[model samples]
Target: MQGLKAVLPLLIFVFCVRAKKMRWCTVSDPEHKKCAELAKALVAVLPPAAVAAFARLSCIRASSTTDCIEKIRANRADIVTLDAGEIYSAVKQFGLVVVAKEIYSDGGCILSVAVVRNSSVDIRSLQGHRSCHSGARWTAGWSLPLGFLLSRNYLSWSKEQLLSQDVSTFFSGSCIPGAAAMAPALCTLCQGQKSYIRQKNYHCETSHSEPFYNSQGALRCLRSGTGDVAFVDHLALESIEGSDRDQFRLLCTDGTQAPISHYRTCNLGRGPGAGMVTRANFRKTARKFLTTAQTLFGPRGRERQRFQLFNSSSFGENDLLFKDVTDKLFVLPDDMDVSQVLGLDYVALLKGLGHEGSSLEDSVVRWCCISYAEQKKCEQWALSIKSDPLVCVRAVSMRECIEKIKRDEVDAVSLDATHTFIAGRCGLVPVVTEYYEKERKCVPAEGSTHLETDVLPSVVAVAVAKRSSRSIFIGNLGGRRSCHGHMYSPAGWLLPYRHTLSLEHNSSSPCDPDQVYNSVFWKGCLPGSQGNLCKVCMGGTGEAATKRCADNHNERYYGNMGALRCLVGDPSGKSFGDVAFLEQHNLQANILSLSSTGWADGWTASEFELLCGDGRRAPLSEWESCNLGIVPPNTVMTRPVLTARVYDFLMKSQETLAANPNTEFKLFESQQYGESDLLFKDATQCFVHTSHMTARSILGGEFYSHIESVFNCTHSDILEFCNQDICSIFE
Candidate 1:
């Protein structure tokens, strides 16, 4: 009896663990009935040991897919199947994760194709013809076909205008269900409520009330000669009853026609089919339940005569719990997020179609500015640009600017090396890069452009010091005062500080570069820093003394010119910095302008010297050989969807405004705004459209590898979060 008691607790715990229950959320009565039938049938066929691997199946009824999403979010249910479009919303808006995807015989994706009865119609000539679509915003039906047309320039659409308007115009009359309110003519051919066609509410609904509301329904529209062409999944053609299938053909983008069986080569883009979503934490549970369910009621199920997992014909409907065409449920990897499953290009297409928000505006490119002075300069530049109106949007910091661009609040911004890395990690791409070679007209060349061939125009990062600071060498500068442009600026902090960290140091905290800098330097001015790092910072002169340690232009020592001011000493001549880490682009110009602008009494270009990595100091003019590293030029960045448009607008602005010296408003010049580089670097000679290059490619392999090493060890919260987010999705 005592031995039995010892193992009794273990036996009970194992029994409880094996008795887990899974609640499958269903959208309709048919799905609920089919789910219940499968739930009962699985229990009778699977042995106790086999059933222990999965949860006891149960059904939870919901009114619609949106309701199902909410139930699953609230944890009232465990798993649910959704359309590809609904899956996007479930994952993005509801924080749900995709566990598995329904796959047909071909694969996990479905081929979107345009079907027609007549073979003479070319793909480009579909305009002004009646069209049939599966449904509004559906992947195979509407989004894919429309995205293909818009991306290929077969249909014209402006970001400022509604896509429905362009689509309504593209087709003279159509059977586009669920879009009656957006465009009524799109439902002209839709057979609404077969027996009650006069009811406008049922005319173009997404439900059975509208005859031409789904893939099968859309094919019926094409067969009845109600529409000239039908855009639907390739599987929908298989539903054609016998001889009626011979009347349909597929439309190819290359202006040719192919038989329905040749849809693999003649179709719109292949998009992810229906996906199964659950709460992120419940993914394992959902996966196990799906795997076990597939084993029992699947095609070769032991209880196939009782219930079918993928079929719902017994329930008096098609595609009840899952798509009838689904051959199997392919479990996705844990790392595959909604974006990965749908693909970045497809997500970009959805965003361009204004699914979540409008990422691009044809009327204007909202330029993101970091500071008040930068915003003022951007506003001024906006006024001067003639093509593609420019609008200025303000953010508090560079990271915030990147976040705004990611959220589609702002269109584009110019980012330096360090922030550009973070932006790329956050999924933004470079549209244009600052060119420093020389001024040239924006004309087509026979050979590849500099950017196309990956010949980046780089600026030299130099460690500058006053000629009098003789003891401050690159190797032995501990306990000496330092100057930096700002906290995260490439030349001011990232490059130079990282290079300094590469040298030997005995500090306990070696992971955090900021802490190491603060510990090594006695007192220095590094704007946007705190405590000792901001000790040498001279805030605004008069009433702005309280603005010390600020991260913007309000601080006197905040940029390349500001770093030079720190090395030149304060106006009271009380505190002088030992070294100034800056770039070589405007070094001579800023040094010469100091004396003329009255910021310094007797400043000369010869008063400064560059410290080389070999422990020897060279004159400022020899920075090409004595610098720390060659930093890539600032890049204009935006969401992937807006890369082409932003690049075009910038190219236009350069040709019409900055290309000519006679124009009063210069796109690159920023001295008038009381800052050195406001919207763009003042030394920028031209803009290189980097349509083919990513932020990593623009930084080049050597520089990218160097920065990656530095970033891997540094303790930057934003960069860490961005990297972690990226790795969780992509890696």
Candidate 2:
């Protein structure tokens, strides 16, 4: 947080505005410097109908694709064009969002093709064959073909060796500018032999002086017999189609061959066609900009200008601002995000090619957490579920964890109900939920009637007294000894308190319950409290006493189970509560039984019971009659724009973790034994599957809003603050 201070405050303010004019970033390659001219041309050509909403464009120059991605993230620029491979990086590394894609002139997306001379003998083996590549890591030359082979395990390379070594082994020699720094073998067959060997280190570089570079130059190498085969895109072959059409043959992956123009049927794979991207938050802006650009230059648009919207040759590079093959600014369907645009199998392909480790990461699910304590336990949990282990990544907070998810730094997280809201608001969606088999009833979270269901009931908040006790009931419970879980919890504090305030008590119309609870309860143990409230709480003596037990181990009684334990009291056998307010689950979860963590604090389920209406007592399972309120369960949430990888990963985890017979690795059980629930709830047996529901539906509209209202209240609104009596006592 402190590090943000180094950034200028004015720039932050400027970055936040949803301005009318957009900054369009263009790659500034010195070798192909027409990005400036192309930017002017695009701005000049926008359709007149879009002038009011997006009247102008401010062009920003970026030295490379990586630089352009950075500009988009910092908000110094708004939009840029990228290939599928670069788009993958931009989305994963820079949080860039995709809005529109470049449709080729022929109405087909770009395709990657491998070309060899027609007269070449049936070339079964590429080993020792000289080759020419468009460039390193470009969708056509590298990502598609190499990604295809690597993902299928056709090639093997060690992390210790450069990727160039893998390339060098597959092909005897090559000319690829992208490999100049890393792989010297690729440039071995080049014809250029400049005098200044030191100055022109990569002799086969794509300048006019060098014979080969880019898609065109790589094909030129094939035409001139400089290399036996050329790895390039459909556009590269199209460049020489008229005069030199018979000179090249397309190499298909299945050990077959086709003519140069047979790219549609005989090709490596669909190349990641060029796309325009912007910062994720600017989805609306990017959409407008793309629609306007396409309206001005789409196939349907009036071609008022000499230079076309998708013309890369206008800028001297065949695929400069956009691909040379691009004929229209196509709008992607709303369902197709950048990842989907790349295609699922292709994403796996790219990941395989780029993997630094020898083995595939496809089997592992990287889980996100906010602290070392969680990660420590998660590591052990990972060991238990060895089938598909969890690898942990730590962030500063929940915000950072979601931010990391956006950047592909981590996979998933188990979120609380409210935090799930924040994650959804950040574009994550619910993948799965902690499904307690117990059927719970629920009212609409906001503005509607409750959902209808048969078997599964909602979890109700309840007020419990011993079944043997004959006098206690909901109506005359004032001045009773109370036991409650932590503050702000729905069951323990909010719902029960809401119910208490609604009762027709013999008192003045109460606007505030903080004053009422302290006066009503004879003595209460609400953990994480001080003064008289702590007098009832059982925090052990010594250093733990100094700490406020607001969260977990610091408080002797926390969660629903903790409040129940408080009612039965501790090892000293001192009974504490006349009534315990908590989730209805506590009644059924046998407190007498030994948990994986061991015995339940020297207490038994038989010692306590549920207090019902009219001062009656029922067994724990019959909670439909004696409950305070019910709510939906906790959920597993992810970004709304989820890729198939993440969705499948989570669903697989849900199935694998819950299928264990011996309960050796329980996904719902507490990771920590003695303290409050750590990774998951202590009460949950197994999560039953449910359709993805929003955080609002999960928390219930009324309860969600109630929490919001209480949270929004000022500290001065509390009676404790008014009287200097301490706020913790109210819980």
Q: Who wins the lDDT comparison? A: 1
Worst 10 residues of 2 by lDDT: 722-731
The TM-scores of all predictions, comma-separated, are 0.66, 0.45
lDDT of each: 0.76, 0.59
Predicted candidate 2 versus true structure: per-residue lDDT over 239-304, tens digit per residue: 785757876788876668888778888877664566788876776767765664554454454432
Model 2: how far is 245 from its true place, Å? 42
lDDT of 1 at 294: 76
Error of 1 at 33 (Å): 5.9
- Per-residue lDDT of candidate 1, residues 412-486 (tens digit): 899888788889887777777887777554344677433343476789888988888788788777888988988
- At residue 690, candidate 2 shows an lDDT of 31
Candidate 2: lDDT of 439?
Answer: 41
Each model's backbone clash number: 0, 20
